[model samples]
Target: MATSIESHVVDITTCAICLEKLNIPKYLPCLHTFCESCLRTYITAIFEKEHKQSIECPVCRTTVTISKEVNTPDEWAKVLPLNFLIVGLLEKEKLRDHKTMHGEELKLFCADHHTPCCSMCVSIHHRRCAKVLSIEDAAMEYAKSDEVKYLKTHLANVDYDVKVIIKDRSSAKENIDKDYKRKQRDLEVIFSDLVAKINDLKVRREAELLKIYNEVKETIDTTLIFFQNKQKNIENEKQIIDAAVNMASNVQVMIEVEKLKKQVEEHKQVIQSKTKEIVNYELLLQDVENITKLAEQMEKACQISCKKPNTYIALSSVTVTPNVSEIFSCCRFGQHTCSWGVKGAKQDAICVSLSKEIELYGLLSYVCKDALATCDVTATVKDDTTDLVVVKDTIDSKVAENNTVKIMFPKPVKLLANKKYHVVVVMKGTSWCYAGGDGETVVDSNGVVFTFNNSPLSNNGTNTNAEQIPGFVFKISDEL
Candidate 1:
């Protein structure tokens, strides 16, 4: 058995192509071993001649693929570290032969001299020189030193620090995200409140402006009504005067000799009565002179003018302007000159006595009992006046047994036939003695009182309540 095994082993050790001990043996996947040179040459020749991309093993004709598996030799067992089984299979002599033949030449150089050296030369000659070191010697020493050991320790510390830093970074990022969300919520609430407040203020301002506009409109309307009435009165007065002048001229033309003689006797009485009537009318007109002036004064007090009316009347003829002063006299009384009165008394009560006329108008008719007293009344007539008729009167006060006073004027005088008029009254109480000494003056020393009522009436009739006064009234005629 020993003899037969020796022969088999010898046969396996020899290369089929080279016929030499299989040095640098390369085993195929077919379990056949061959010389490395022979296999390399064969693959090269086949690739060059046939342009084949892959080859088959000689023994089994299995495809010898050139991937990781083919790139490694089957005989790599000889190069690996020896174990008990490996040593038994391959003799020490065969192993040495494999290494000597297959091992690639390794050329080591001195770092300083740049000269190649063998392994024997590195161990003996490069021992003492500082710069004269071999690549192999340096590599071996670096692998075993404390520097390598320290690098290992540093690498472990670095890994631990990196893990701690990563945790902290993640936690900080989470906190930042939470804070940002909170701020976003707060901003939304603040913006909503601001928008609501702005809208409220806008609504309030709009309401206030609307109210002011309405008030202004009402004032404008009132002023317009006042001027419209004045304009109508002016036109009416012009027409009345023209008619009176025409009548007088026609009567003068109708005079005859025989008729004149008989008419002269009758004319005296008629003329006398007519003159009295004229005087009474003139007095009535005079009483309201101050009131008319007051109206004009009141109109002037306002700065704005009335808008022009849609329609207007024209005056056809002019009349002689009467003397307004001849009608009423202004009087001032009292220590402080705080009271104003207008007075005119005529004898013959039937001749429209001033007392009766004053009482009739009810201007100052409140003080009728004290018409004559140790007192004086006064009035003020303003310039550039309009629309106020002032009437003054006195009457007996049933409650106090003293004289009561009154004053009044028209609110808005209407224009009739181109003429407008107003009346105002003013009065004050005075001390009087009956059967005793001077009567005790009432403590109501604030006696200066004035009242005003408006009449659009063309002529003075019975006094009416202010509320009863008609609105604007006028007759429109083309000729005025």
Candidate 2:
């Protein structure tokens, strides 16, 4: 029976074409197996000779169609299904051979190399190592060492510090983008106003030029008509004198000449009186010269200058209540929303303490909405030391946009400095959501230091350690 089993295993493991153990055995639709290299060679030969889209199975002579995804003969064998059963058998055979040749399991730990090894491996490679321990002993020693604890603490601190740095960089980038857009808008307005003024000036100048040209033309036309009338009168007087000379005697001609002489004297007096009006006339215009000067002046009219920004410039000022002042505020860039509550536990709270004495009137929280639905959120401030709910108020979630709504308390409560307080926020219908910047951020504003804590407080005064600290601004009626 053992002989028969050995022969059966050999038949399945060996490739029929190569008559050797399969290296990457692949099977055709006919269930015939061959080595990957042997199959590729056969397929390439058939393709080169026949140039057909199908090939005959080597053992069963069954036709197998090539898929369109198989582009070349070299890829034909790769597209065939792998014989996982044969592969598993081969792996088992390899593992059996490994155990027979190597003679043991990896039960020793080489402390010098920090790796596991068998007896043969230790004798062959780790003979010169200073120390070696059994696996059990090594595990116990590692568990008791302080290295693990120190590493955990160090990694946590480093992660938090890196997150803090990332938050700062993200905020700086957001500020730069906002400032760029603002400056661009300001520049556009300035240029637009300048263009409007230039257009108005152009219209007025053209109208003035036309008015001056019409006045000059009218004066020239009137002067031409006056001179032509005077010439006609002089010619008529000379003609009358000539007619009298031709028709009458010498005495009559003398009388006519005497009468014409008086008229000629009157004509001379009229010409002398009009000599100034009959002088040469020229039209001169200053339109071109004035336009050129204006063009030159406009080039330097609006000067653009830039300098380093000494401080952060907000895009718009937020309108707060009359007497309320903000004490703490977190950045709102890289905006994110954290689930303030999960299933079963629908109430969560963020705890913080102030370093200054003031009358706490209200608080502003940046919230998120799943849809445009009306939802009411209740915020209650509880004193940690006294275990008393100091103040409570409710605000509609629809009004919360970038700290737009101040959820005010019914009455202002005065808390002592250096006291811990928590604001528990509750909402209906779904998990309460709050917006955060960079997931975690720390800020120092208004003489108070605000630190981000990943662990939020539950209703029962226990650390949930699930959600990030919500973004909020503490409002006080008086300045710190």
Candidate 3:
């Protein structure tokens, strides 16, 4: 049985053509095998002689068709699947042959050289190495070393970490897909709605553009049809005259000639004409330009507005109840002087009269020379006759723009029409706030003057003539 096994191993592994061990073994159609290089030489010689592409088995002489596309034996071998079972048998035979010649295993291991060494190998190569031990003892000793334990632990940790990395990579891909789909959906909603809006406007604008064009086209068609009918009638009359002249006798011709002449004269009479409706191209162009302007305006106007009063109302004149609101505000880049300083508990008064009563919602002022970068102040408007406070506003200094300060009244006060009022402004910070201006003071034709003093004064020119107050810039809404 052992002899048979040995013969069978040699038979299975040996190449028939080479009569030696198969190096890169190749198979033929008849299940016969040969060495790749030897078979390639035989195929090349056949190709040279017969100029045909085929592999002929050396044992069975069975012809196998080689691929026409393959130009060389190396390329042809690559095209075929490797015979892995034959390869495994060859490997087993090789190990068996090794054991037969050199024994089953090495008995010693050279630690310094880090390789298995037989007795002959040690004598030949490992004689200079410092460490050598029995193979079994070397294996046991290295297995218990600290470095080995550390290597094992680290390998286990790396395996666990690699699994986690794969899972996270998969999760990242899923997250990317999820976000991509979500963003696409949001874009679809916004742009699709915008497309719908644009389409609707397109229909409306196109309809407007086409209305005049259709009307003009219809008119031209009507005019062409009328002239065509008239032309056909004239041609029919000419044809009839030609027939009469050909078929009529001389006496009949004499009678028909006068009748034809009279008919021609009658045909010469002018036909009543209808006035053509002409569309003005200039007017049409104007309409188009207006629509283009509207498009540009709405493009910027229809932005996504935030939650604020950038929203506006275009109120009609009739909606305003009969009240005195400010009309004109001509700003005076006036000198920054003539200030009334009412610091601490002290206050200053300035009186200004209006020919028409005004509904006071807000007031404006300028700094006296320079004060704190920001200042706090309070203003009170009082009825001169009634001595009752009409409106009061506290001005907290904020980012001032262009050196002008404005504060809106918490509650708007409608002053009595054509009546004089005393405005007392108290400075909370160490700064003066003017309630009236010098030449900048604007009064109607009713000789309404202005008065200013350091101390709070009563009405009626402060017991004397009123001075033109300064630094008081007033803003109003009613018509002058």
Q: Pick the candidate with the highest TM-score.
A: 2
Ranking by lDDT: 2, 3, 1
Candidate 3, TM-score vs. the true structure? 0.28
Q: Roughly what TM-score does model 1 have, to 2 decimal places?
A: 0.18
The TM-scores of all predictions, comma-separated, are 0.18, 0.31, 0.28
- Model 3, range 307-414, lDDT digits (tens) per residue? 111111111111111222333233322434335453555444565555544445445555443444445556667775454443343343343444556544433466
Q: Which stretches of candidate 1 lie over 4 Å from their true place?
A: 1-199, 243-376, 379-403, 407-480
Error of 1 at 320 (Å): 30
Candidate 2: tens digits of C-alpha lDDT, residues 1-480 = 999997898899998888999998999988888899999988888889999989998888999989999989778888787776677566445433312226676567687876657888889999999998875676556556553344334333333333332343345445444544554454344334445666565445445434543444454345444544444444444344444434443333333344455555464444334432322222222233233346556434433232222111111112123232244443323454554432233555666555555565556654435434343555667775354443343344566665335655533556566666776765543545554444433455566555433225555222323342244445432443
How far does residue 225 in candidate 2 sit from its true spot (Å)?
99
Identify the runs in model 3 with alpha carbons over 4 angstroms from their true place.
Answer: 99-107, 118-130, 135-480
- The order of the candidates by TM-score, greatest first, is 2, 3, 1
Q: Residue 11 CA error for candidate 1 (Å)?
A: 99
lDDT of 1 by residue, 408-476 (tens): 221112223212234322223354312111111111112211122233331322133211111111112
Specify the poorest-scoring 10-residue window by lDDT in model 2: 310-319
